[model samples]
Target: MDTVTHALIGLVLYKSIQTENLSRESKRALLFTAVAGSEIPDIDVVSQLWDRGGEYLMWHRGITHSVFLVPLWALLLAALSWLFWRIFDKRIFWLGMLAVFVHITADIFNPWGTGYWEPFSEMRVAIGTVPIIDLVVWALILAGFLLARFGKKPAHLVFRAVACLIVLQFASQTVQGLAIKESAMSRYDQVVLAADFQPGTYKVIGKKGGQVDIVRTSLWAEPVLLHQLTSAEEADLQPLFEQNPEARTLAKWAPMVVVEDTPQRLAIYDPRFFDRGGSFLFESMEK
Candidate 1:
């Protein structure tokens, strides 16, 4: 889910929780909290990519996306938001929770997963069904926002629209996941996707050459066969490394082209979303 989806989701949740019982001020404050909370979880990306480089290793997709941050951020913001909220409604607390959950939920759908249960399992879970910027969901949210803003639509209609978008995205993801699985099977008879990141990206475990081949997808990443760890490849890589160890190092971070029989095979292992060509032997992951 993108910012629009999350923000609209927060608005919908806030509206439902405080349907009819609201002083003008509490209602106003919840709206503020609604929008802010909806956008806040992505603040973790700031700690990851903004100041630092895009490297996922550089404090990216880390604790900020962790489960701990849910309570940590909710508590931190609740007091401040509560002060501004004149109407005392406990429903506001759920609104805060909705905002936080929306952020984390959206995070999981991205290529660089939100590390949802971080500090518990350092897993990067992705649905890979919905493209992060899903047009259908966006159109629905944008229409809902516009409707509420100008049309003065009923709050119930606003809430239903957002829910419909969420459900639509969920359905899309499910279909996409199945499609990828079917496609993976098409390429290899005994293919197994160990982990799928987002929008058709995955970490694949394929049974080939009487062994398990671990295939990783690069950022903006497309899948490629890196190397089969055979005795021949092992022997070849050693001397190759002895000549230019830098190639191995470069391959660790991004794609490296190795031509054979006038055709080339690429190797990629870095966590970048897309490659911006650097001098190292590896090619950029993007098209």
Candidate 2:
């Protein structure tokens, strides 16, 4: 998810807490815990500033976003809250854990996944059932914000309702995406699904050997063929990797890539990001 969405999720969490009897200082402390915990995992993004080996892609959502680090982050946020406000409520610790957990879980569902179980596993858990900036989620949270600003109901109740709706939306989208994948299982040796920005729409990528088919479809509609790609699985990519550092990093990061080999150059790009002309992750080396 984007940074703004992550921050908004923290704000929603802060509003959902029952702080009716808490002192002003305690409430402020909880808010700090919620927002800080939600954003702390992304601090690994700073690695790009000092990265000279083209490893920024692997380091950004690496160990810092690990499930093992969640408790450590919560503990740090709780300690900071105590130091800043002198309010030592246990809710501060628990709220920090919840905020950090939500951030990790949300990113797992996005196409740009995080290292959910790092150290134990190196797999990128990208379900691709949710877009990074989901309009439905945005609308639900924005509606909750408006209701809290103007409605007669308590802000906590409104945000709680919004949270439930967001969960329902996520569940519905996941089920549909899984169903689409199941429908294509027999046709392709490997399949990947990417959810469109609009609800109920998806791009189903099916790969068999060197052939790949990208189809745009929905739950109730016929699949529309978008682009058919071919990968040179037998091509020698070592020279490309030797000359292009980004190609080396991309080959390690992407689940699969489409290769283009010609007399002038050897180029490769991730099929997942291919649209219109080409993908930004595309790299080539001249002969």
Candidate 3:
């Protein structure tokens, strides 16, 4: 999920808490724990400043987002709260854990996955059942906010309902994506799905030998082939990798990639991101 959604989740978590009995300073500490814990995993973005060999591609959602590290992040937030506000509530640590855990878990449903088990595993676990910026999630959160504002029910109860709806949405999309992949299995050696911006829509990439097909799929409509890509299956990539190291990083990051080799240029791109004439994630070097 995007940063805004993460922040909103943090705010909702904070709002759900009963803070009436706490001191103003203690309440401020809780707020800091919520927002900071949610946003801290993304601090890995700073890796770009120090990256010289194109390692930032792997570093961005690396070990810092790991499930094993969630507790440590929570502890750190709690320590910060103690240092700054002298608030010594144990709930702060647990709440911090929840915020960071939510951020990492939400990312798994999107096409750009995080390294949830990083340090132990280098895999990028992307389900690709939801877009990075899902409007449905935003709408649910917004509805919770409105309900709280109007005192329709308890603020915490409204948030709990919103949370349940969000889970249902994830489950629905995952099932739809799996069904689409199963349907494509008979026609292709391997298939991968990338969720489209519009819900219930997907870009299905199927590969067999040197031929790759990018197809649009939806539960309510027939599949449509958008692009047919051909590649030199045995093309040498040493030169391409030497010229653009990021190409190597991209290959490792994406679930699968298509290589394009021609007299004019040499390029590598994730078939999942294929757009009209090109892909946003394409890395190429002129020949």
Q: Which 10 successive residues of model 1 have the least lDDT summed?
A: 254-263
Q: After aligning candidate 1 to the native by TM-score, how far in Å is the CA of 120 from where it should be?
A: 1.7
Candidate 2 lDDT over residue span 1-287, tens digit each: 88988888898899998889989999999999888878889999899899888777778788888999889999999899888988888888899999999999988887778888898987778888888888999999999999999999999999999988988999999999999989998999998888899898988888999998999999899999999988888899999988888888888877778888889989998777779968777989999
| TM-scores vs. true structure, each candidate | 0.62, 0.96, 0.96
Show model 2 residue runs off by greater than 4 Å.
none
Model 3 stretches astray by more than 4 angstroms: none
Candidate 1: which stretches are off by over 4 Å?
15-21, 48-58, 146-153, 182-287
lDDT of each: 0.55, 0.88, 0.89
The predicted structure with the larger TM-score, 1 or 3, is 3
Candidate with the larger lDDT of 1 and 2: 2
Residue pairs with backbone overlap in model 3 = none
175: Cα error in model 1, Å: 3.1
Question: On residues 128-148, what C-alpha lDDT tens digit does candidate 3 reach at each position?
Answer: 888888888899999999998
